[model samples]
Target: MTREAPRKRILLLTDIPPCSNLTAGIVTAQMCRFLPKDELAIFCVMNPHLRPMLCDDLAGIEMKTVRKPTELQRRVLRGIRVGRAGAAAIEAMKRIALPRRLIRQAIAYGRAVGATDLWAILQGQTMVRIAAPVARGLGVPLRVHVWDPLRWWLDAHGVDPVNRRLDLALFDRTLQQAASCAAASIPMARHYEETYGVPSTAVIASIDPALAQAPPPKLISDDSVVIGMVGQFYASEEWAQLVTALKIAKWRVGERKVVLMTFGHERPPNDVPDEHLRFMGWMDQPEVIRTLAEHCDIAYCPYPFAERMAEVSRLSFPSKVPTYLAAGRPILFHGPSYSAPYAYLNERGAAYLCRDLYPSAVYNGLAHLIEDSTLYEATALAARGAFLADFTLPRMERAVRRFLGYEGGKAGQAHGLEVV
Candidate 1:
């Protein structure tokens, strides 16, 4: 007779704990759904100072938080006056010794809870180093959630090139052995799957249904067309092009006006003319979605088109897609042909897409939205369809659950993986 399998208990090791104040934490909370309280635990490293940022998102179940090794080491080094060699020695020693403590603590907790699975959240370096060794010691299948560009992430965190190469190698090995993998976007998942021949699922953390409702119809000004953008601003030149297009779309004796309204940022836009711009600085997300639905005629999404951003463009899907889709706004994509957002919207004919950076090209796309009512309705409908089809919290949760245990998960073997 076959022996019965043990119940699955997960131990998540991460540098960013699950909290509502940050995007990574919010996404992690979604992954926690459909699991029993006692079955999942979090062992995370966060700056104690950011404790105020913690919310009730993870109020129950088991959790532990520790300061990063570098944080602790820096505090120690400040207390003593050491020569360069001595300082380097002390720092290296602490780095080695502290990770040992983390490893021991992680293994102990895993054993205490009879953990059947090990999960790692890769936002930075420490967890990547710590989780793999601990998983090896625990004899459990390792599940990896990769949400950031690895090289970009490392570089952002001040990792030098030589060490970045070493860390990348370790990351590859860890990914190689993982029972399953999840990426932040479809392009990222495809790249990892092709490179490592491992099953990887694309999981975009999307809004709840309450936030996905279509905006109530409203009476827009007959002469004004409102275009809205939400979330963090990154591509400055692209935004300038948007402002320039708005200016260009003006004139022609009683032609309808085009207005650019933006939310979720506090900084004043650069050289925006008074007649064409509205900046609502940092509204709450629900309100932002509501505003997008009720008021805006079109939603704008852009990505950098420079050669330096090629990898990022190809791999990282814009998080704003879901927001725009959910709000039933027709997405106005301004980016290179190779970007993830461009490929996604272009493939479905779901948006008024512009491939060039010129103000005239951008204005033409805007004019299509302003002049063609059919284009607006059709594009919005297609975007909403994409949202319902792929981008939603429930869909994301299902993909993660399937990858975690539903199908190919076993106690020891991790070779054969099936995509959900």
Candidate 2:
């Protein structure tokens, strides 16, 4: 008798994808790119209100659009909506009601597509209704990926005491229900285990290898120094802090320049007077890397004072950390000493860390790197080495596949195949 082919069906449920400005959307896109295309079938569900834009962008994947609510669903949705002000109320209600319905729909959709396994990516309180029952009812293992716990808590409707605690109760129940869970970083994983009493084995998060193998750094002119920072600008004060540091760097380096490169929806203020500062907005990944490698001399990873709380700080590991490492340059990190990237930097001897967001501190750090040729080369080389050893896409793929028990050749022997 012939052996059957391996089952390759998977259903990924998420809120944002190709059309949104959120980090979740970017991470979801990266996940799709990392998985073996021939071995995986992706089914995505996004906010119904964004269907038009998302439909066009998600052309290659199988997708279903879910609207905010119809007249009837709205009535049930309204009771669950959280927050007294803004659209948070409507969004809160939708989170509680939508996930349960979406999971049921996902089961039917997966069955129709001959899927043997189901994977649900839970954003926040939605985990309670979406992931729990599907794992129990379908007898298929479920994985929950958490990025921002605080954001989830605040944004989730009906989870708090004022909302009758229905959502919070359900959210906790899903933790016990899921077969496995994944977080964006080790810190996040720890948070999940501590707060929800989930097993450590259930959490997994990694950086893609493709991102690390960015084209080798290109040489630029020596007359001006370019300091680059990427990702969305959520806090304007943080941007101003960066700009202030850049201005201080300019004063020290004389003619050296600084530039802000953004990859999302946020735009820089038009009235900023720094000639050294230039904003390149919303570039694709390849373009973002190319621009950084060719023009940037230093990569700045600055965090403002507002992001210091343990609840917020412990749950997030900036995606840009690996991207900056892959750039083959010296990194200037302005954040807490206990941050994950700081730990990595200290381990590898690859970066400069600053406790405060002072201009003088920023200037001194960059000056040390620029002035000492030996230190500059050593730092860059160490960062690149660390990227290959720990943060490469193939490295991450192996870890994920092993965690999922998807990495055997015939019977039990694991074939160490290269990740494409």
Candidate 3:
């Protein structure tokens, strides 16, 4: 019999909690699911005021919650956001003051739990900045997972220019200090290596195995065809273009109708007519996938196209790609050619590609997928192949294992994330 690997206690010190239905929560939950719960613990820090987004899958895992954006942080951030001429607040935010209090809490928890390793998911800048130091104090290895480019993520969240520049530098330092790191996409991995001279493994999203075993979705009821969109909108400019494109595309094709069906986002888009919009509200990830499979004839995915978003566009991969691939529909991808998702899908011929932000391009790309049966079937087959080849539970599991230095036969190494 093969000898089972020895257990290594792991502490997940993160900014995103398991309760969020967002990418961080979904991806983090997947990473934790295969590990022994008894040897693992969670320390999450996020603003406590917002309602948890609820990913029921990870609720059973034990976790200690800490509040982020303390009153001082909030006031300082508000000052920066509104450009209140609060130079002191901006300066204070830019100064990285050792993160002593946060480090103390993490160390106490890590020692108490006998944690052998610290695995951080890059989300909140403060938590990410502290990861390297805390792991050093605990005398444990550190591994970080980056689902988005840290710089762009901060920019997207409206982090002020000064803090953002400082945080990016700290992020680079942490990357150098880490033993391994995992990125969300191949382009992201390449960017890390080329720009930072740090190699990282690409571990994108995955779908439940059961979802792949089933037959393709039944035809939508009635004469209406639906396009699927999942999760929150990150690129405001790109998504606004999509809204206009969907409008320009029209809602009817002969006797049949077409609509954009979306779930997970809290509010439905107000610009679209009720006739063109079908809101499913928020559902768990699994439920969202299954429902999309059942109701959607085509799935739409988006990325930013503005010059300002160019760097972020290349490094950030959407969580929806694998989920949509597993759902077995012809994907309608709208983004720039340089984008991670577009490049991946273009290479695989997995999705109908719309490579510009223009409404006409988006309208034409989606229309081709809907109107051309031959292209639709071919794209669907390729999408499934891509999912099976790269994005699956098994693949993600192995990547996570390698990142944490927990792969069955491998031995542990020095801390500081090198990216797995």
Candidate 4:
């Protein structure tokens, strides 16, 4: 009898807590689902905080948690100075020591799971550092998923100068050591090539087939046109701009009420009129998909026009666009044209894009979409077509499979691996 080949083991190292509502977690779950189960064994890191939500059934997979050695100390310190100073101190320690701790724990977990054939790290400067040494030690290939450009995201999010510098250095070194890298967008791939001299494949996060296969129930209201958005609103300026644009659209569509329906956890600006906005709080994926399909007449995907956003926009794509497109609603892309979603969707006639970073541009785009039913239908159809052609789960899975060198049969299994 022919003997079966040994299954290659893959370790998925991520900063994200699995089974959460976060985009990275969802993407990681999909990656787990589509990878060749017969040829590969999957292992993932579980954040302690997400243990309660760990009910997602990932059969035949192994999971490990690396609790920080300093977690108790950090908690005690936090208890002592449970305010700004304490927070600053803990952040400093995390920046300085977290990478090493994560790496050590990852090594321990890797050994427990037997020899690993490859290391798969989700985007983050610290995660890259944690995975790189393991891959090098095991003589195995490492794959880094570039969800966002780490350097720019850190800078944009107000990371301290010292930590930012250290993280960037480590990030650069990690990429140099990586066997391959996958980016969320083509522009991101090109940026990696130009900036680090490392070629990358674009493996964009895409929509699940279950979510994309059906059209939402049509619930049109004669009195109001509901414009919906889902996800965290990280930038206040962007939210403020959106409110201003909504006001403008309200005026243009005289007598027709405009409602901004939002889903997810965030505090809306007090300045924006409460009557115009409806906060749905947080909902699960199924509810979100249902609301998008049945309730919304228009979908809004906004990126901030802040310096950090403009910088990172050239290097990453938003995971939310596929969801917005799958809703089969007219989409208003509010952000710089350079961003991947705006650029690609606008080029494909899938959305009405506001290239200029002004509320007037938003006003004009909204007015054009709201007033012309023919244009609205055409744009909606284009978005659905684009989602099917480029942003569906099957399409993404095929691309990722090719990138991982998992062609037909159990070919190109990683070799020369050693237990930690």
TM-score attained by model 3: 0.87
Clashes of 3: 12
RMSD to true structure for each model, in Å: 5.7, 5.4, 4.9, 5.7
* Root-mean-square deviation of candidate 3: 4.9
lDDT of 3 by residue, 1-420 (tens): 899666789899887776655567767776777576676888887767656675565566668777664322233454345343464365355354546777888898889888899988877677766788889999998887787767666655666566668778889888887777788787777777676665578877776555762324333545776888888777666668777765555656445577878877565554878878888987876777788777788888888888877887888888888888888777889888988888889899989888878877877786677666678778888888887877777667677777777766432222211223
lDDT, candidate 3, residue 318? 88
- What is the lDDT of every predicted structure here? 0.73, 0.58, 0.74, 0.67
State every prediction's TM-score relative to the real structure: 0.83, 0.77, 0.87, 0.84
Model 2 stretches astray by more than 4 angstroms: 1-8, 18-23, 33-43, 48-61, 68-100, 150-169, 190-221, 246-263, 269-271, 307-309, 407-417
lDDT of 2 at 307: 49
Native-to-model Cα distance after best TM-score fit, residue 167 in candidate 4, in Å:
1.6
Model 4, position 150, has a per-residue lDDT of 76
- Cα error, candidate 2, residue 406 (Å): 1.9
Candidate 2 per-residue lDDT over residues 55-103, each given as its tens digit:
2434566665454332111224346552344344555566667667767
Model 1 lDDT on a 0 to 1 scale: 0.73
- TM-score of candidate 1 to 2 decimals: 0.83
**Tens-place lDDT digits, model 1, residues 102-154:** 88888888888788888887666667678788998899988888876676666
Of the pair 2 and 3, which is ahead by TM-score?
A: 3
How many clashes in each structure? 0, 6, 12, 0
Better of 2 and 4 by TM-score: 4
Question: For model 2, what is the C-alpha lDDT against the true structure?
Answer: 0.58
lDDT of 3 at 359: 79
The residue-by-residue lDDT of candidate 4 on 1-420, one tens digit each, is 998755566666665544547667777666666654443444454445543344265544676655432222122353475454554466567766776766666676666666445546555445655677777666667777777777765655455556567778888877776667778898877777677776578888776555763433332776677888888776566667768776656533545788788887675663556787778887776677678778788888887677756757777777777788777776888887677777898778988988776778776787787777788878888878888888776667666665555547532222211111
